[model samples]
Target chain A: MTIADQVTGTPIAGTADTAVRAKTAAPAITLPVVGERELRLDLFRGMALWLIFIDHLPPNLLTWFTIRNYGFSDATEIFIFISGYTAAFVYGRAMLESGFVIATARILRRVWQIYVAHVFLFTIFLAEISYVATRFENPLYTEEMGIMDFLKQPDVTIVQALLLRFRPVNMDVLPLYIVLMLALPLILWLMKWRPDVSLGLSVLLYVVTWQFDLYFSAYPNGFWAFNPLAWQLLFVFGAWCALGGAKRMSRILASPVTMWIAIAYLVASFYVTMTWYVPQLGHFMPKRIEQWMYPIDKTDLDVLRFTHFLALAALTVRFLPRTWPGLRSPWLRPLILCGQHSLEIFCLGVFLAFAGHFILAEVSGGPVMHALISLSGILIMWGMAWLISWYKSEADKSGSKTKNAVSNADMAGGG
Target chain B: MKAKVLLSLILLCGCVAASSARAEDAVPAGPPACEVPAYLLTTESQLPKTAEIIRDNKPLEILVIGSRSTAIPSSEDSSYPARLQAILKEKLPSEPVHVSVEIQSKKTAEEAASGFVKLMEAKKPTLVIWQTGTVDAIRSIDPDEFRSAVTDGVSALQQAGADVVLMNLQYSPRTETMMSVPPYLDNMRVVAQEHEIPLFDRFAIMRQWNDQGQFDLFNPTRGSELAKQVHDCLGRALAQFVIDAAHVGPAQQQN
Candidate 1:
């Protein structure tokens, strides 16, 4: 199997050679295409997923571990960038092999799947909020969740939701993802001819977005929490890197000067973020500096945030090589499993984050309770990932048994 | 075991005495019960326009743009804005200090910000104190959007020739669990810093008060009377904050 197949997390169809190896492999192991896949991507994507889950819940001491506490960017950037990279890596191969028409069809199919997931998540989310609000006599749940419009005018809100204009707090990511995925076919098509110019076009769109203050109007007022126009730059940049940009910059990236520059940028961002928490640090920060740094706009994907994420990625690549043994460690297995099954795990995370928030708000909100809720939420995500992986492997085994008798004979001989 | 208990009691007593002593030091000019920390009351950003107006001995017109928190039910005089006006008038007897409140009830920062140019054109105050973030937080507006709105508002206010002081959300121990507040709070602080203006950290001050047992913020039994006391304390604290940021005290007068 190619690396593309592994990145997409779709195990190859049953063959006699693979069936023999599967039986010989450990009974506990469920991960498909482990050694061939880019473990670094899976590992970091998994870590980002966990961080997103933690950040979604109400703020607690546990939040200090999130990247937002230390830098300008957060898990959202990592998720989007990796998503772009993986999409391009997997589908670019498919496009090359099967031609553009087939690839575009597959992309649309994925977009439809995401759209369905988003609608489902939205429905369940509204139900959860309304149920909690009515059952507990705490109308704040509906209000605080930004579902008040839905509660008041379900008809209009449902249409707006279907149009992807209305979204509750923490529900913004999926809609943004849906839009990005829908645009990917075109992006991939453009990249096929000229990857660098395509990225330049994306950057131009970002600039024009800021210049004209163009954004999609959210329901009741304001704009999208994650502006796709500005954010598409990062996504396209990821795709660019996956195609050939990284290879072109391999020498520059390997240079000591580039590494030090990335390190300096990270340290500077850390210091700036620290000054937000510790006001005394403001004494060292000049007024002009503050003027330049104010409104580090996350919605529009500020340049500082984009650069910060790039710096982080640069450092990550430097340190965590693909051959790093830590990637294959047993401790990181749960995270890897979640990352491998990112879509379902992400949906689960969104649901569990609200549930966690409800428990903390309704029951107790002490430090101990915060710790328990955070740990258990992640444990549940991990458990779901493990179950899905196990089930997929079992299904694969059964399919192999039905399709090929030679594999079954090899499996029986190995057993 | 008896010695250990006696030692612990002595230590506790010493801690109480030390705290009381600190509170006493802070209470000479402020209210006896509302001794805010020096750091909480002070701002690194100075109100230059306000200081200039005070030094010139002109009428100090202060416009308070806020939401529901600016007013009290059935007792307009007990609201923070009213109490602030009273305190400012009492302190600056020579200068005609007028604190007028414009309540933007149930409005987010963006909505309120869009109204600033028109409001400032009419009001024309030397100092504008903006109390926001509660409605935005409750409504779950995007923090980045909220930050940009506040930035635009502060800029508008400054261009209108007013020294702006931003006030963040009120702290309630009960709602603290249900809603997320730090993003709004941090964004406000960033805006205040970026504009080189003082932010009146109402959330931090109130949270400090609750933590110190100065007020039981979680208790519903105290009701409006408790709200009155809290507003009064907030008014007095805000008055002091304005004075310090403007640097209009005896030391500044001598300078």
Candidate 2:
């Protein structure tokens, strides 16, 4: 019944049989029978990370190619969704096998790690911006990146940074992720017991928050850029799908009607985006309709953006199955690697994006310069991912080899 | 020796006279401080109504709808709008060229736009130069909403029988980092293009001046003097832009 059981390619009835057989035939637990890694998740997540890096630095021509220009939702939606799916996939199993307290502790540990990373990034990002600002003798750079407040009051700003109240530009996502991760245990528990009811409660919360205009107040002004109260819906939705929501929706997902609806919505969103660019198309759009859809708020995660993301996901799932051979191709390996080490790559990306912006701003900003910066930034990210992956594998090998050596010594002593 | 000095002085005078005469025959250049790139002043779009008013030798009533920057706080006469009036009067001595300013301080594009219909009915100017986007960028309003508001305002102005010239946000190196401006700037450009109107790229022109070291925008000590100089340059540039858009040169005037 658990995702872990499903991942091992055993039916509900066959799970007990497989466990009994494993106990009798083998001393240790068996490895997963099926490839449950879901390379699609990693590939998409990796692509999203790269896109986020690109989108963070403005005035780049590549931004025209990003999903934000073409559609309502962007890489942020994809990142949050996959994060939820993976969190549920990993922690759900832990909670089922070990216990609730242990699983909660592990989630808390991840939250702490993410919090530390955020603090580290905040410090480094401020230092980089401040150094550039002073070196170039352009205090505008500091003002431009919203570092003027930090300069005015370092002690207060540092405290605010630690509290996740103040963040410079392009450093918002990590804090949001931290808040979401902090709430995972409770979400996972409710999901385990009452999936539908829990999901209903999340939707209700979203609606109530919107109605009451409730949001975490950001430092030196307005609310959080990515309001956790609202964005938690997407994370919870992803987790639900990880549990049994996808299975429940299998029939609807496979239906031709649903496919056509999703396609139609996507086309509508595409047309709306086109109007933003080509104003000639905008004339044809009814004035009343334009008034109704004037401000599609990204901060609160408007319904249009949410549905657009859903439509996109639907089309993606319809086309790309789990068994797609392209998932294992050499071309996609870099993305998968980046996705596996997302936290490190993401932190690196935020730093790199700012660095790229600095290079473009201070130096020449020709098309060729942009090309060089973009390509080099992504290459560095890929290289970091590869390096981390290699180190992790080597560490795993050594860890297992040490265990084996310890056992061998025990055997010799016994003889 | 006195005769030789007199001869040199006469020669210098002759050269100066010849150059001045040539300048009169050619296009009259602006002051050194007001000099901007030709591309910034030139426009493909025409102010047809303004041109018609010039041809008819009618009173060219131009109303400027802008924020606080439109007027200089220290000296009102040194403001861009006032300087524009002075420049226009000098350029068209025969015609009564009146430039009036209406300050819509601390208002976003949407708010300013909502008042256009009523304002147009009252002012009834032949040309309307709308300076906007600074407040909108400061507030971080939705770009789509900003664009729509601009479109609405432009249409309303056009419908009111006024030629519209959009003036985008001011260029300050400090505020550039504090707010995201490209969206609003791009949206303004797109709206101007869509409506087939002229866009006075104030941001670009100011940036050009700053980059060229014509003005020290970073120095706080310059204060009111700096404001006056920048405004004067802007007014001169805007005057040239209007003249070019209207095609009111000697060649066209003779026709």
Candidate 3:
């Protein structure tokens, strides 16, 4: 029987049901039920996108409200982890149903799509910065956005951009994501064959990269801002959890000891991060120890940052279980919508951040202006998400209508 | 006979010295041959530890900490830090010099300063070249807060036994028109002065270059080549500025 029949306690007649029954009867590899969309992923991912928008505004007062102020990790970590989780959820299903080769193709196609989106975003971002610079007769914007190279050698820079080696400011993350997605097929294959070995390999790479200072180099000079070698550990860990790791840890997850540890870590991280804002308290640590602890290399996904994110994740999972109806509440609908259309919203956010910076600079960038710009930018993102959702719904409706018409005609002809 | 011999020798020596003076005068002094541009130099006090390191022929370590600008691209070796190392190596070939960069990544002076101790511990550079104030200026951060942050950062660097050279905001025509940079620049100067550390006047130097048409700041088509040239010049100027601050010359040693 089909999932729909099982859910509604009614028979769904036709060849589809019969095929599902035949498949179920054979039963060595039972198809997993595709359940309701995970509201928590959408909710949190949306929250991360918003935080990114606010934080990108630079000198804004509202940045204090973002997750960065309270922890070593920030929105980037959240966004990336969620991406890994969702990718596994979607692609894992495809592999189970459509088989390995098709799943690999699907993953590769996604990589291409993300790469295209990244290029498109880069073009628009560069154009926006260039246009603003020209309009104001200030070449500094080009310099500020790290586009002087492109202006100097468009031919070479364009080639580098296509290669994902030349990225402007706020444009680095997409490249990192692209690299991670490129490896998704292998990651999934490993997870399917040997889950523990896959995770072990990911961790090994993370440690090796951090220890040896290994990273992919950007064009001209320097290394990728978000080192993929280090970051892939988190992404892989997220996927592992989505596949079955979380289920294996159910006892530990439910344990009070684990809960307390997670809470304590979060609290301590919160205090330490706050001290960075308040110098008097910040200086309480010994210079030697502080120095050793600091400059926690964000590029390499330093161990402290990794642990902090883990603690935050643990607490989040504990408090907000999968059954938490609060995720589906009207109050969080905007976040859910944005999360659903994450790639589009993220690209839009990058543009809006530049616009916000421009507005803050051009207009009175006081607190009021900061607030206004932030609100407006977020509203625009929400609007874009809503529009995308609307378009998708309309297309789906059209598709269903056509299918229904074809079926009706077939029925009549058969009768 | 002895008096006559002495007078002849003295007369010969005087004539030889006079001819040498005339030869020196005939050679033109072109713009004081300033390896480091005058505009980029400030009257801040010397870097004692840095000088000692250079004078001892020990390795001179410089840590360049700033935003995206800290890592401007042309080639791996073209970054200001790499160029600075090359220039320093050329100037003090006997001394092993290494310049490393730590990107603050869109952080303000306050945020960047918070990580000084960590950077110092990891790199343990003798001299910390802080390129700051741009993000703060753009964000319109409070001058007092900016000053405090800079002061704290300098103090932290010093406490870690590293000499500090505060590099001020870069002059970008676009940024200049958009935000008032004076407050942040002035605050950095105040902090540097209070801390008795050298302040590399990147703003004044870039502005001078732009104003004097040394570099085409207004060129709509200014490309990576110009960026390379600017960074190269900056690297050379900064190397000289550090060398001067560390009191590396014979004149400084005599003083």
Candidate 4:
């Protein structure tokens, strides 16, 4: 808005300058606020990323603690949900401050970040796949790669991922997250222009996530991929909880009728989950898209998953502490720091993970060597993060030109 | 034609064993009677009261014993157990039957007896169809031992208030190894005769089909139309027998 000054009468830049200062940097940790926010969002994101690393890492000693055969599902559900909560917390204010234009820019930047991460990860995945393929090529199993496969595949354009209208075989959640973030501008627009409308729309999106599972179940045997539509309700739910929390939970908690309804809703959702008999268990409910009768693909959203997610969201929002007990522990300080800077730490963690797998499991030795390598990897990533932060602070000290780097980005964007 | 004739003879012989002399027309009415081929075990069939009993509208309880082949067909839609249930319902529409054709543990008649007793007690069945000896035939146990175990099983079912019927092993061509059925089937027939229980005589049906060139007995197709033909034949027969054994009468048939 500020840069496009020629089109408007109002001084968009000046208002933005003022709003930007108030919004860019979150409040400082005086007593417990920063600590609490970090735990609420970052801890969950931090832990999920950690599990993901362990899940992918090769045979190693760390597998004992890190690998989960069937662990906390909060992996995909909590990460995206936390994304929603953070989007609501940060972007909701952006919408209020600079209006929808900057909100669009913000959503775009976030999606771009996910896109960049995916491109980088895809390159690494290919490199590893090729390396392994050369060592184990057979009719049943091949560790071979063709250049055409990479060229044809990496060509799945940004447009396809953002629309979630394309599926590249063997990919995971990066595209899904990118596609979901594309909806942020509209979400914020609705939240700003009409809070009730936006809130209702979020609820409806959640219903879509629940209703869309049946559509994808037609494939033979089956597929293990997560449906983005089915999964986004967790984020939308987290967003709602972040934006609209109330002590007025007391109103319903003590009410006998509300308690009974909650109990009944939870039991029914659980039953549906256990049985997998809901039509959405295998495919999406098609009737919803048909006004004149049309087809809407969920891609990953299935009905029971949506309901199960919602039931979990409602229960967590209704019952969980404003600040978890784990947050209060001094022993968890390093975890808290790692959690706060999760994306950066995750990049480092995954880098170390590859090194761990190559050196330990690939070395053809006993597990003791693997354990040593894993510990060394963890410490190395931790040290690398600590050193980077130290160097960045030192650079800031010598530079006399600007306000904090965090604020500089906000100012440069004029938001 | 001779095989069909012989199957019909075996079935008639089975009817003769279970039906009391006066039950030629005085048999009780139930789901068992619905299997009378709609032609043979009719209201006016000249058989014992058990035949009359099978002609009536009483619920049928069928016990199927077989291996994975019988329990779960490549197409579940045509599994023998599922087919038998369909036949009982189609024939004895007035008498909705409960069919329990369990995966009989390869041996241990003592264990198989529970499933049999439970089905009989719940449905108060007038007839049953046993399809074991195929598995026992594969893992060759002594034929006499098989007979005694099966006899004990039949005694347990009769004690549970059931009119027991055993199906003789027919043919198994697909499996690499098979237990020869001549000894097992013959022993089962003797036990059925001694206990006065009906036997389905699937051996006779398969032999007839093979001789007629409808299917080769030992090398029949994996999932052939003949299997379904034999399944329907036995299901229809069992429903009629149950109805006759229930002593259903002509007046009830009209109503």
TM-score of each: 0.78, 0.72, 0.62, 0.45
Give the CA lDDT, 0 to 100, for residue B199 in model 2: 93
Where does candidate 4 stray beyond 4 Å?
A: A1-38, A58-72, A138-171, A194-196, A209-224, A245-328, A349-361, A365-381, A384-394, A401-415, B1-255
Error of 3 at A388 (Å): 1.9
Prediction 2 TM-score vs. true: 0.72
**Which DockQ values do the candidates obtain, in the order shown?**
0.15, 0.06, 0.03, 0.02
**lDDT (Cα, tens digit) per residue for candidate 2, span B95-189:** 78899889987787889988998999999999999999877765666566688899998999999999999998776654433455666777787
Off by over 4 Å in 1: A1-35, A128-150, A399-415, B1-22, B25-37, B48-62, B74-78, B83-99, B107-127, B133-163, B171-191, B206-233, B248-255
Model 3: per-residue Cα lDDT over A134-155, one tens digit each: 5543323333534232466878
By summed lDDT, which 10 consecutive residues of candidate 2 chain A come out lowest? A1-10
- Candidate 1 per-residue lDDT, tens place, A1-415, comes to 1111237422345544553553354222122232367878877778888999988765555676778878889999998898888777666645554467877776766677677778988888777666644544221111233324347788887888899987777788888887887888888778877777889999999999999888888876557878999999888998888777787777888889989999999999999877765568878988788877776777899999999999999888888887999888999999888887777788888888877766765666555676788899899999998887786567556675556555432221110
Question: Taking the tens digit of each residue's C-alpha lDDT, what string does model 2 give over A88-143?
Answer: 76666556554688778777777777788889888787776566445443322212
Error of 4 at B195 (Å): 35
List clashing residue pairs in candidate 1. Answer: none
Give chain B TM-scores in order.
Answer: 0.87, 0.86, 0.81, 0.65
Worst 10 residues of 1 chain B by lDDT: B1-10
